[model samples]
Target: MSSAKRILLTTISASPRENVNYQFNNQVAIASQAPVALIKLLPIHELPDKVIILCTQKLYDEQYETVRNLLLEYYDQILCNTLNQRPDVTEVRIPDGRTVEELWQILEAVLHSIPHNCELTLDVTHGYRSFPFLYFTAALFLKALRGVQIKAVYYAMLESEETEKPIIDLSLLLDMVEWFYATRIFHHTGQASPLCELLRPLETPPAGVTGKDNAPYQLVKSIRRALENVSAAYAQALPLELGREAEQLLRRITQPIPRHMEQKVPLATELFGSISSFAGSFALPATRQRRIRIKEVELNLSELTRQSSIIDSYLKQGYVNYALGMIREWMVSCAMWNQMAEESIYRVDWWIGHKRFETEHKFAVLARTAYKADGNTTRDIITPEQRWLASKWQFFSDKRNQLAHHGFRYEYVLHSPQQIDEIRAQWEELKSFVSSKPHWNLEIKRGQGTLLLSPLGLSKGLLFSALHHIRPDEVFVVTSEESAISIEEITNRADWSGRKYVYKMKEPFTGFAEAKTISRELQNYILKSDRIIANITGGTTAMQYVIQQVTQDLRLTGIETEIIAIVDRRTPAEQVETPYVPGEIIYIEGQGRLNPPPND
Candidate 1:
C-alpha cells in the first residue's frame, strides 16, 4: 500500500556502438515526466542539466585541458537552453583503485555543490556494470537524500556477442531489495530485449496460489531473461571452439601411425570395430556419427582419408552424445529431488495410511506368503495380519494420486515454498490424528482358528468380539448362497468341539414375489430365534435382493432384530435393485447398532 518513492532510468555501454542510440531514445521515452541525469566517462560539449561527467584519473591526465573546455561548453549550452530552469551539470574524477564507497563519497561531494532545488536523476546505462552499480548506488542515495526523490535509469543489452553476460543471482538480489523499494515497473523493448520475451505473463501460479503483488513473478522473469541472454551468447561463440576441441581429441586418438604397419585392411577394420563398440557403449546412433563426420571433416584423395574421417566422425558424435546424456541425467535427478522436496513439504502422509502403506504391505505380505506357501527355505518376513493391514492401507492409493497428481493444480500452490511448508504441517497434523486412534490387533492361535476383519467387513466383527469378551454365546449363520458345508462346519470343528450353530439357506426364487415370501419367513425366524448369523456373499444381485425383502418384512411387522453379516472376504458390489421402504433397524451389524441398552 506504500507509494513509490523513486524512479530509475539507466543506459549502459562498454564502448561506442549502434545499440546506444536505441538505448538513449528508450530511456528518454520511459522517463519523460522525470528529470533525467546522464553519467558518462566521456566529456561532451553539450549536456543536460542533471548530467554528471565521470572521468577516470587516466582520462583526466591524458585529456585534462580538452575535457575542461568541453565541460565549459556543455555548461554554457545547458544555461542557454533553459532561461529559468537550467540543469546542474558537473564534471568529476576519482583516483584509481578507489573503493565504491570512496567513489560514492566524491560523487556525493559533487552533488552537494549543486543548488538545493535540483533533484538528482541518475542515468546508469553509460557506467561500468551499470545494472549492479546503479542498484547499489541507488540504495545509498536513498539513504543520504532522505526526502528527495531519486530517479535512476538502467539499460542493458538483450544479447552481446562481444563479451560474456554477467550472471546475477536474483535470490540474493531479492533479499537486498525487498525492503528498499515500494514498487518497480519493468519496461522491455520487445524485439531487442531477451528480458521481454522471457518475462511474459503466465496463465497461473506455477506452484501455489500467488497474489498479484508477489515478487517471484518479477524476479523469475528477470532471471529467465538473464539466462536466455547467457545461453544465446554462449551458443554463438562456442560451436567452433567445441568443434576444434573435438578435432584435437580425435587427433590424439588416431594421428600416430606406426612405421612398421603393414596390415592396412585389418587395421582399418579393427578401427571401425572399435568405433562401433564405443558408439554402442555410449548409446550413440551410428547414423548420427556418419552425419557429423560428413559435416565437420574434409575428405581428400589421401590414403588415410576414409579411415581418419570415420574415426573423426565417431569422436565428434560421441562428444555430442555424451553431453546430451549428462544433461538428461541431470534433469532427471533434478526432477526427482524436486518431487521429493514437494512430498516432504506437503506432508503427504494422508497417503501413508490410505495407499502407501497398503500397497507396500500387500506386496510384502504377498511375497512372504508366496514364499512360505511354496515351501521355500526363505524366512517369513511378513504375516497374514500384515497382509490385511496392507489391504486397508492400499485404499489410500486413490487418495495418494489425488494428493500427488492433481492436488497442486486444483487445491494448492506448487510455487510458493511457504505454502508448501504449511501443507506439510497440515499433513503432520493428520498423521498425529491417526496416531492417536487405537488400532485393532489380530492374533491367530493354533487351536483357536483365524478371524479376518477389515474397514469394510470388520465393523460387525469388532462389536461382536467386544460382545463375546463380555458374554459367551454360540454363533449361527443364515445365508442366501448354497454351500456344501456351512457356518456349522466351523462350529462343529475340533477347535469349537461341541459349540452349537444353525445354518439356513434361503431357497432360490425366479421372481420378486417368491423372493419376498422367503425373505419374510427368514425375518420371522430371525425375530423368534435367540441368535442369528448371516453370510452376505456373491455380488449385488444376491445381497441387495435378500436385504431388500428382509428389511421390508421387518418394517411391516414392526419387529426389532439384529442382523450381522459374516464373510470371509470383501469386495466392492453395486446396488442392482431398489429395496422396499422400511423403518431404520435397531441394530445393523458391521455398520453399528442403532440403539442399545446402556448396561449392554
Candidate 2:
C-alpha cells in the first residue's frame, strides 16, 4: 500500500478476519488468506517497502503467528513472487493504552517506531479503541515538530461477504487540522506563510478538482503578497503602514468564497472573522488618519496614542521583547515632544539645525533625567503623569538594554514578576495619560514643498530624470566616494537649479545600522508633513532596503513619505527614442503616481 521508502504503520486486530472477504478492483484477500484487509488495497500486486506493526504483549501472544502466516501465504501465492523478497516488516512493542500512563507509552512507542521526517502511510482498519487516536496524534507531532509528511491515512470498512468495502482516505482531515494550526499562528504572530503554503495546492485545481473547489486558493493567492507585506511591517516594527496593510489583508479575505466549497476551503472561509478581528486591532481612527494626512503630527500626541495601541497589541499577544524596546523609545519621543512644547521655537530651531546629533543626544538625556527625577527639576519638560510614564520607561529601558547586551534576565531571591493586575493597571494608566496629552505639532510655512532623498549611484541621467519627474524643492543625497567622481555633473545641472542640495559622503559600502542612522537625520530637513520621496532606484542593496524601512518610520515621525524604485525597463531594450523617459516608478510604501518630466 506504500511507495518505496514510505513506512506503512498498522496494528494487529484480534477480531476474527476468518469470516471476512475483502474485494476490490478484481482482487480479493480473504480473512483466511490475509492477516488484514490492508493487503487488498495494495496497488496491483505490490508489497510495501517497509511495514511497521504496532504490537502489544497480549495481542502478540494470541495473534502474531496467525497474522505472520496469513501475510506470507497471501504475498507468496497471490503476488506470484519468485525471488522470495518480503516487505521489511518490524514489530514494535507498545502498551495497550488502558490508563493515562499506558496511553503516553503508546504515543512514545509510535514516535520511536518511525524515522525522523519520513513519508508515512497509516492503516487504522484493525486498531483498538485508543490505538488510532494515539497514532494519529503522533503523526501530527511528527509533522509539526519533526517536519514529517503524512502521505495517507486509510480505514477499510467491513460489512458483508458479497459487498465491496470502502477505503476512506482520511488524509484530508489531517490536512484540515494542519491548516487550523497555521491559521491560528497567522492570527497570533501576523505571519501568513504557513497558511499560504497549505492554500498553494488550491491555487490551481488538481486534475480531478475543478469548479468551486478552487475558490479558496484563488482568494488566498490574490492577497498572498499583501499578507506578507503586513507580516513584514509587524516583523520590522514599522507601524506607519501597518494599519493600512492589515486593512488590505482584511479586505481581500472578506471577498466572498464560492458557496459550498470543499472542507479545506471552508476552513479558510471560517477564518475570515479572525482576520478581520486581528486587522482591526491595528487600525487607527479616522481623526488620527486625517491628522496624519495634514501637518503637525511629528512628536505628536495622536500618533503616540496610535503606537501605544500597537504596543498594547504586542503585550496582549505576549510579545514582550517587541513591546519592550518600542515602549522605551516611546518615552524618548514623548520627551522630545515635551521639549518642543516647553522650550521656545528659536532654541528648538537652533538646537536642531546647528547641532543635529547634539539635539538628539540632548533629548535622550532629558528623557532619562525625566525618568530618574521625580521633583521639579524636570517639571519644565515633563508633566507629572508624563514622569510616571517615564518611570515605566525606566523599567523597560533596563530590560531592553539587558536584552541587547546580556541574555535572559535571571530572577534571584526576593525577585518576582509584577502582578498581572498591577501590570495591566499601569498600561491602562499609561495609555490614558498619553491619549489625553496635547499635541505640540509644528506647522510649516508655504513654499516649503517636496524633498527628494536619493542615493548617488552611477548614471547621472537616471538621477537627473528623477529630479525633473519628482520636481522637489530640496534634495538630500547619499553618495558613496566611488560614485562621486561625476557627482558635479548632476549637481551643477541647470534643470535641477534653484534647489538646495546636501550631500553625505561615505565609503562605497553601507551597513544597515549606518543607513538607519543617516535616514533618521533626514527628519531635520523634512518640513511639517512635507512630501518626501525616497528614490531607492540608485544605491547599494543595503541602501535600498534600509531607506524603505526608515521612510516608513519617517511617516510615523509626522511626515509624508513614499519609497519608489525607478528603472528604465523590466527587460532591457537597445534602442529607446526617449532616453530620459524615467522608465517605471514603482511605489514601495504607499500609493503614488509617476509624474511626467517638466516642460519649458
Candidate 3:
C-alpha cells in the first residue's frame, strides 16, 4: 500500500498587478487571507504537507522568491512566529513551453514531482500558454497510472476589469468527464455500473428528497433507471427488452427539465442535453419500428437495426465473443423477418402471432441446413441465397461454441494456423451483414424434427453416418456391457450436439431377451419428437430385434418411425482402413400412431 498526502500544485508568473483588493467571493473557504496571491491562496487554504510551484527560467528568477517569502511570513508572523512548521515548499523548473517537446518536458516535470495517490489540487492561475492543457493531460494520466484523486482545480480570471477578480472552480468539469467515460463504456461493452455510481454520488440523495414534489430527484432517478435498464438489456442480448427500455429512456430524456435544476445540481440541463444526444443516437425509436406480422413472428426493422448496432459497437471495441454469440441470434431473427409474403402476411400489424419460439427454432434449423441441403432434400424450405449466407457462418458457429465453453472438451488447444484469417474474413462479411437488412425468401412452415436411435456395436461409422446425414434433434443409444467403450469411440469422432438417451442391455446378443421388458423400458421415456430414425446398422441380432420392437411400440403412440440400415460401400479392407467414414443409408418406413397423416 502506497501512502498519499494532501498536495497542491501551482505555477508562478511575473504579472505586474501584484497589490489589489482580492476579496474571496465563493462559498468555499479556499483561502484564509482575502487579499492573498492566486497561487498562494490554495497553499494557505489547504496547508498541505507539500506545495509544488512550477516555474520557467524568468519566473524563477523574478517571481519565485516573492511567493516563497509570503508563505514563510504566514507561519512566522501570523501563526505565533513558528517558521519551522511551514509546509515543505519545492520549486520544479520546467521549459519555456514554446514547442511541443518543451510542453512534454513541463508535463513530465509535474508528473515526476507529484507523488502517488495524493489528494491533488491544481492551481491554473499562472503558467505558460500550453501549461493548462498539458496539466490536464498529466492529471488524466496520473489518475489512471498513479491513483491520484483530483480534489479541486482553481482558475483566477484576471481578465476582469474590476479590482476584485473571481476565482472559478473548474473541478465540476472533471466529474462531467466521468460521464463521457460512462456512456462510452456502456456503448462499447454493454456496461452501466459507472453511470450508476455517477447518478447517485452519495449513498442517498442529499436531505429532503422524498416524493414527486422533488422533481429533479425523481427525474434523476428515472434517468438512471432508464439508462441502466437499456445497458443491461443489451448485455443480456435481449432484443425485445433492449428496444423497450431504449425507447422509454428516450422519452424520459427528451422531457422538459426544471429551470432551477442547474442551481441545485451543477450543469443539470447541460448534463441532460449531453445524455439526450447520446440516447437519441444509440437507443431512440427502438420500439417504434413498423412491425410486420407473419404467421407466427412479428418483425421490426428498426429493432433489428438497433440490435445490429449494439453488436457492431461491441465488435469495434474488440469484444469478439459477445459479437459472435449475438450474430447467430441476429441471423435467426433476420430469417424470421425474411418470411414476409406479398399479400399473405399482414404488414405493420403489431399484434404478435402464435408459435414464435417453435417457429424460430424451425427457422434456425432451416437457415443452418437449408443452404447446404439439396432443395429436394429440404422440401424446398431453404433458399439458394440463404444457403450462401449459412455457408459463410459455418465455422463461426463452431468458433462461438469453442469460445463459449472455453474449449474444455477439446483434445488440444483450440487454435489453427489459418483460424484468425478465417475469422477476419468472417468479420468483414458480418460487417456487411449488420449494415443491411436481412433478406431471405423463406416461407416458414413447421417441419418435423429428427430423432436418431441406434445400437452400439463393433462399427462406429454406422452411427456417425446416420447422425451426420439425419442431423437429429434427439438421440437414443442402446448399449450393452461389452459395447460401452464403443459409445465413447463413436462420440470421440462424431460432433453430435443434441440431447441423447442411452440404455444398457446386459446381454446384447442373448436370444432369451424379453420383448415386453424392452418395450416397457423404452415406453417409460416419453417421446416428444414426432419423427424417429432407428438406425438398425449396429449391435447383434437380439439387440436389433429389441430396437425394432421398441419402434413398433412407439408407432402405437402416434410417433412416426423410420427404420434405416447403413450398407458400407467400401470393401472389408477399405472398411478396416477407414472405419470412421460413412456409407449409404437405406430408409425403411415404419408407421406410428396417426400424426395427422403427414399431409392431412
TM-score for every candidate vs. truth? Answer: 0.24, 0.58, 0.62
Cα lDDT of all candidates, in order?
0.33, 0.62, 0.64
Candidate 3 has an lDDT of 0.64
Candidate 1: where is the Cα deviation over 4 Å?
A: 1-49, 55-69, 75-84, 91-93, 98-379, 382-600
lDDT pick, better of 1 and 3:
3
Model 3, residue 510: distance off in Å is: 13
**Candidate 1 lDDT by residue in tens digits, 45-72:** 2233444555456545554445345444
Candidate 1 TM-score, C-alpha based: 0.24
Model 2: per-residue Cα lDDT over 1-600, one tens digit each: 433356788887765555566665566655632225666557734446567888888768887777766666666676475764666766888877789998898888889888876788888777677777876799899888887778888776764444665566688778878777777888888777887777666566556766776666566576666677778888776665675576667667677754433455546656767767776777543343433323222345665777787888777776666776677656555545554544442232221333334333443433454544445433344555545544665555656566554465564222124643455566676565553443211122213467778776655555665676677677777766676665566655526653555444454454656656665455455532257788887767665666676675655444567777767753334213333444556677755855444474
Residues 1-600 of candidate 3: C-alpha lDDT, one tens digit per residue: 224687778886576464544434442323322223544444444556677888788878987777777766665654474454666777999888888888888888989998888988787877766777877888888886898988878777777786576777787777667667766676556677887777764324567767765776677678788888877877776555665676778777677764444543456566666555545545534344445111222455665676677666666666567777877677656655556554634454322333334334444444445543543545454455556565655556777777778768645535564765566577666546542434343332335566678887766777777766676776788877677667656665666667777777777778436555665544323334557778887878877887788776555434457888878888878876787786777777754222121122
The model with the greatest TM-score is: 3
Q: What's the best-to-worst order under TM-score?
A: 3, 2, 1
Clashing pairs in 3: 371-387, 555-592, 555-593, 558-593
User: Could you tell me how far off, in angstroms, the CA of residue 127 lies in candidate 1 after the best superposition?
Assistant: 13
Q: Cα miss at 263, model 2 (Å)?
A: 3.4
